[model samples]
Target chain A: MTTATTTDLYPTRGTAEVLTPRQDPVVWGAPGTTGPLRPSELGDFDRDGFLPVDALIGPEDVARYHAELERLCADPAVRADERSIVEAKSRDIRSVFEVHKISPVFAELVRDPRVVDRARQILGSDVYVHQSRINVKPGFGASGFYWHSDFETWHAEDGLPRMRAVSVSIALTENHDTNGGLMIMPGSHRTFLGCAGATPEDNYKKSLQMQDAGTPSHTALTELAGRHGIRLFTGQPGSAVWFDCNCMHGSGDNITPYPRSNVFIVFNSVENAAVEPFAAPVRRPEFIGARDFTPVR
Target chain B: MTTATTTDLYPTRGTAEVLTPRQDPVVWGAPGTTGPLRPSELGDFDRDGFLPVDALIGPEDVARYHAELERLCADPAVRADERSIVEAKSRDIRSVFEVHKISPVFAELVRDPRVVDRARQILGSDVYVHQSRINVKPGFGASGFYWHSDFETWHAEDGLPRMRAVSVSIALTENHDTNGGLMIMPGSHRTFLGCAGATPEDNYKKSLQMQDAGTPSHTALTELAGRHGIRLFTGQPGSAVWFDCNCMHGSGDNITPYPRSNVFIVFNSVENAAVEPFAAPVRRPEFIGARDFTPVR
Candidate 1:
């Protein structure tokens, strides 16, 4: 494979430093270990394969990252397709990794000792970055993403990292039910629901079922939230939710005209691993620019 | 934004000529002139917002594309993280556009009168290439990707283009239920289910419902398939599927140890509109060389 340029592969000198203490030297007990996260807080994570941590970042830091994103989105050098431009222009723009590069706030959030300690306790080892992305869904301009699991897209491998993979999303905005907030399927991750594996012939029939079922599923979940007590993580800027990647999740359309933004970072263990970027039928242009990027090893 | 080089934006001299014949003239008809698509065929796409056409490209062509993809994947110059390599790799690899760029096979497939006729009937106007992509899902080596909708990912501006869009995928391998296969929610395209307005709070609870519900909505659909007398579309390599962008669709895991690959191309009207590539948040180092790419317009 082609090698990345020095600049593209290594962290820039101006890269942001994570302000939180690293858990590298600290070995903490399970989720309940003294810290912000409680063992019960991670209860869902254990049974269902994912959990959402509330408000990992604060509003001031969110505002700063938003400002940086605004600058980047405004850069003329960045040429996006009409659709992408429209999406970016309609929302507050920011790069997930860029914030980590420029601000100690993001770095600290990603490296938060409590979060990391919990990750290790739940996952059983150190986790590495699978990828990081920024979500900028502008009011009325936000695209309603679909609901699906992160693991379903892969070609199963022998040495694949365990299902312990987790995706942590840090809300830079107060994500509510109206502004294109993230939606997820709770316990779906726990069981290996045999792949639907619809055939070309079966696709049409299966699709109909999915559509019909989607509504009731939504209602069922809504009702359960009211009864069973659903948690609304109205995280202040800088706060985040780290959940299992396998959990079914998606976001609704942005109802308000304001931008609803967040940063999503995925982590997986490196031991006995054979992970690569998920392949799409098409390549994303922005990602192409960072093809040479590599984490400091 | 940095402008794409003319060479990278437009097809090379020989490439443009190759695609000419496939450029079947789009026939416009009065709105509602064409009869509605078959109800059984219309799954989530009809309800959610999209449709699917099976076997758009033949098996032979799919095999050839697969061979080329294998070569590309094995190429040392292709690294997931290297932008410069990705740029160069683009030239060596066979893009869907390039396939039509040099071969009559692709052109014939693009202009397949049956497919175009359907587009004309559905869109009420002539359609053209919005973008074409080569999706190579290498087994074991690939990472799991997110579940999302093509239309929701990109936004449109006033006077932009019709919200209706179609994607034609040509199967490159004999995909079975065992291997990761495509799944869809039928009839989802037409109705704006409550999900359209769901939020983060909805997501937390929705996830819980999925866990409580015990099985995914798709499971119900699978059982209903036979009861509804609906037909599945799994087939040989030559088969293809055409569907709406807004349709709820996803692929299953490649349980088998082989790659599940395919070629995806989208056709859209350019009238009073501009077509551009989708911009993603992460940057890949390889696409820098592609800076020279120009649009066909």
Candidate 2:
């Protein structure tokens, strides 16, 4: 009998596909007892692997976040910072990592209870920012991310050993259905898809702009989508979605004039801090996957 | 009785000075049986906490490395790279992190058994690059680093939990006595000096150029120097020194016409991977302290 160790629980980037049952509990705390999430809401999140909340913040906060995003993108110093990943073809600012460190506005938003409380509830422990970024999908030929589970990449490259992390994506601009909004396969987080192919050396240098290393193959994507069905998230500004790290998700290209932007923050349980990568040649940069595990006060 | 857990073993940045005994072994293997370093050499290292090796690389390799350094410094793309840290006063390139990824020559040097074999022996396990950089001190008015234990700052900010790391400094230029060579307090690595004052938030942004947070006070420096006499290192190009992570060391400013340059590489054992910072509010960038723990093959 083949036994699995803690380190090799969800192995990915192997030669062939190997789907393992999700080993860790999806909702860490007992239903209804944790943070700001209600029992029904927690049940919905556990069942669907994603929970969408309306009016996560007031309209004023969304405006402030939007203004900060514009200011950051226009600043030359921020553009020069290595954390800013520029798109390959469009030459536009694709994503800015460590927004909390760069801007006080976002830093305040990160610590705000409205956002962090639910993450703490879902994660079931004191959490730290594993990674935080502002993704900018500009109109006119903006690229779309291929379908993949983030936990696959995080496990293979960042050395996160479990699915105890959660992603909080708050919409700054209106997420219209026609504008490239996020899409996820509901209930797919129950299975850990071990992707085929090795993560290229220094894959992060290019993967940040255009990722293909840990993306699911067509067969796997088709099966998952067919099994769980795809759910598109389209909502107004101030809406937010909290999704499990392993949820199969991706977005489309934004060719329309409306640019889509969101503040993406990842919270990982301090107990699940990273080690050496499972399948990657090296660990990614700190800005991409934080080395700090200090709990948010 | 206060029993120290594994995480809080080497506590630093506390208000009071706490000198913990070194818990891990200095050298991993039996002296004579280890890699390139001999028994006598290992004894010297264990006794003094530092060892100087003669002729680590031949003249041709030194010349090639020097040429590559010049080429990298002169390249506009490298200058623009955020990894390049410019001197505050001179505006000359001070240091460049992750040179292995940027240059094939340095990458090959990192993988070379001559440099890495000794590290594996001393660290007692497979080692990986915790950090790599080329430090360039321009001849006129280049600033010097203050006397401080690297482990103090590393533990406080970079989240390195132990002293199972060694720094390899290979001279790329002639190190004359007047040209600001490195100075160390011999045998000082036995005691860990927990410095006073909290680490300033986002200290790495400034500490890289002028560090003040984790440095020892003048009183502490006097005591350490008096207890263990200081030793200066002056050698020809291609000579190298391997020093413990906790060695108290610094250098003087370079005012002489001859500039001093060296390739600095830090190797940490995979068994001694980093965790959350014990004191610092946030972890430094990955270029400064790598999150990757993949052992060198």
Q: Which candidate is the best by lDDT?
A: 2
Query: CA shift at B140, candidate 1, in angstroms?
Result: 31
Give, for candidate 2 chain B, the lowest lDDT window spanning 10 residues. B250-259
Clashing pairs in 2: none
Off by over 4 Å in 2: A1-6, B1-297
lDDT of 2 at B101: 75
In candidate 2 the C-alpha lDDT for residue B184 amounts to: 81
Per-residue lDDT tens digits for candidate 2, residues A170-201, read 99988865446787889999999998899888
For model 1, the DockQ equals 0.01
Best by TM-score: 2
Off by over 4 Å in 1: A1-36, A48-50, A78-109, A112-115, A154-160, A193-235, A275-297, B1-297
